[model samples]
Target: MVSPISLDALQTLDAIDRRKSFAAAADELFRVPSAVSYTINKLEEDLGVELFDRTRRKAELTPIGRLVLEQGRQILKASEELTALVSQAKDGWEVELRICIDSVLTCEPVYDLIESFQRIQPKTEIRLSEEVLGGSWDALCDDRCDLVIGAEGVSPMPGFSIHSLGEVEFKFAVAVDHPLTELATPLPSSAIQDYPIVIVADSSQHSPARSMGLLDGRSRIVVPTIKHKIEAQCKGLGVGYLPYHRITDALEEGRLALLTLETPRPPEEISVAWRRGNSGKGLKWFVERLQQMTLDPKRGLQSADN
Candidate 1:
């Protein structure tokens, strides 16, 4: 007979894998390190195999441990889905949706959509979370979030489906008094490189300009968040590149100026993604609302034209 694996053991294993240390996992799981060790030991005894190789400072998964971990993750995800379904059924008239968005620019349309959705479905609760770059993908993969909004270059995970929403146009921008903005004509790529550039830490991968060879290796100041990138630019630390829509107010108020480059960068695609086979009503409703909002005329064009 196959041995039964306890949920506590499975969770402990997951926590250990995620935290990389038994003690850290213990802190997260609210148990002592020895307790976590005991749980794993019990699980291994039941399975008649060792799960982790203890030779390393951190818990290293054995071959069988890897298989068990993969299966455990699937089981946990399914359980969460099941729980969501049950919650939806019991409270069919109300829903709660959780989503993680990678870019702040995409939030404008989504926020408008949520406002409209709440008016129609007042009982539904919506939770929005934002993270930089790959964090959205990580949240979705870990089953911590229901949906993810990201730029084009993000690779879809094995069990997820991606839908193209539209594109986000990027512009080379600088503080109002920055030298690049004083140029009468579009600055050549080589000339632009002479100025220190401020860039979001993980945003280079999604940069349409960089992908097309418009931007070369140049001196750059890196900031951790979109807000910080804009702040860094405004402080005149360096010229910055960002989605045009994100700086519309600043541009209109003359706080920032968009610098015309010799070559225009292509737009990065915007996409909404969710795990495949996910049938949670809240997830379905949230995605539908987002799509509807995108088509609303009052929401305006999805991307800014330079």
Candidate 2:
């Protein structure tokens, strides 16, 4: 019979697959480059098969290596799940939960609510994954996450359920020293269009104001991430749109200034969603906690109750 595979070898293979280079893998695993190479070499010797092609600077997985790596990732994930399950069993009435969140809602008071929930359910294991707005909904549909926090405009797929958390206000903002911030009155749409503007990816299609002649298209830049959009605005790269709550601190600190517009953008609803027929104790507790935290009176306009 073949001897059992060593966990260390499996970990080395997994790191190599993810990092795609011995040096990169070694850096992540905190091992020397030669040590990483030696581990893989020993694993290959024990398995009696070559696992990687080292012809290139970055190691390429051999056919067997690809198969082993795929299985290794699953094994690792399953091992983590198993450990969580054992811990939950010992603690009683507690379970591990994984959730996905949209980046736009990251500024909301919901984070405090989550922390409070964690405090209340100390035995429960919670993990959060953040992605771009619509990506969280995709993760929920794909069964990759137990719940998704995102904007309400996203259409619910079949076999999915959604719960409204609250509404968020968006506004156009720029750096405090930006020329637009010097205006005593709301700038005309024509004048606003004269400066460089940054829009989120596909934002022109999503926001009518962008294409409806609200802002003249004199100059434009499109960015992918919300954080990048904020950074671009903060750096005086361009006037970008952002959630009002997200920019509140920056506005208060004089890092950014809100530009009053003649036409105001409408508020958008935020929601938490999950697949139907998959609800369980863990999901129930999480959803309940989310609702409670968002409904808290002290959270101001970000609260769902507001």
Candidate 3:
């Protein structure tokens, strides 16, 4: 069905209502007074409603006219936003930015980055998702995410570029009262192989899955995220290396105890990665900001409970 209202008609109505006279509205809209009068007359005729009170020398909006003006102002604002979005698209700003963060790192810093980005590009949409182990790199390879943080291990192929975010230190930990804590210091894999080990299931779909700090022939308690692994290990449900930054509170509270291993898990290098040749403004904004900042999990807590 055809609507009686048009954008031009709404603009004329708004100008006349604000200026309080047809001649003044014409001056504001850069149109002749007769044109403004004709527009309001045609709109009232089409809608079959009197939009103005003619008894006064000044144009006074009727109750319905006031409502229409209020609603029309919102439509005008949305149209202006659409025009700005088109302009941004021409300038290489993406309509949306997708970020994939690995579970090994703290998300608080990422949240801070997003908050800062919103202040500059409020029109652009931002999306965030968690990936485990190789899933971060996989997200970029599959084009599921535009940027990946804490992407560890070797790149699956050679098309992605990466910048070091810093390294996450892993420590062997167990619940304070767990049987493994009773074992001698510098515990060897043979001493703890019988205990269940908590592992975060890799999120990779097309890429091969990866694991760390697991010994041969151990009972596995696979969880979906590093946060869960911490909880499981703190409860004595399993034993494994937890990111030193993520488990500091547990260690301080005596919920968990760290043990030395004959061969300790080395610090893993975490990086920010993006596909080569895809240089959207949003992607570059993140890459530049992340490279300049430190990703110390100890200083950046994931949550208050942590």
| Model 2 weakest 10-residue run by lDDT | 204-213
- State the lDDT at 52 in candidate 3: 94
- The reply for model 2, stretches above 4 Å from the true place, is 2-96, 107-125, 202-216, 295-306
Evaluated at residue 271, the lDDT of candidate 2 is 79
Residue pair clashes in candidate 2 = none
Q: Which stretches in model 1 have alpha-carbon errors above 4 Å?
A: 1-96, 104-108, 115-125, 203-218, 295-306
Best by lDDT: 3
RMSD of 3: 4.3
Model 3 over residues 164-252: C-alpha lDDT tens digits? 76778889899999987787888877988788888889898988887754655278988989999999989999889998988889999
TM-score of each: 0.58, 0.60, 0.81
The candidates, ranked best first by lDDT, are 3, 1, 2
What are the per-residue Cα lDDT tens digits for candidate 1 across 201-220?
Answer: 54333222221112553777
| Alpha carbon deviation, residue 150, candidate 2 (Å) | 2.9
What is the alpha-carbon lDDT of model 2 when measured against the actual structure? 0.70
CA lDDT of every candidate: 0.71, 0.70, 0.86
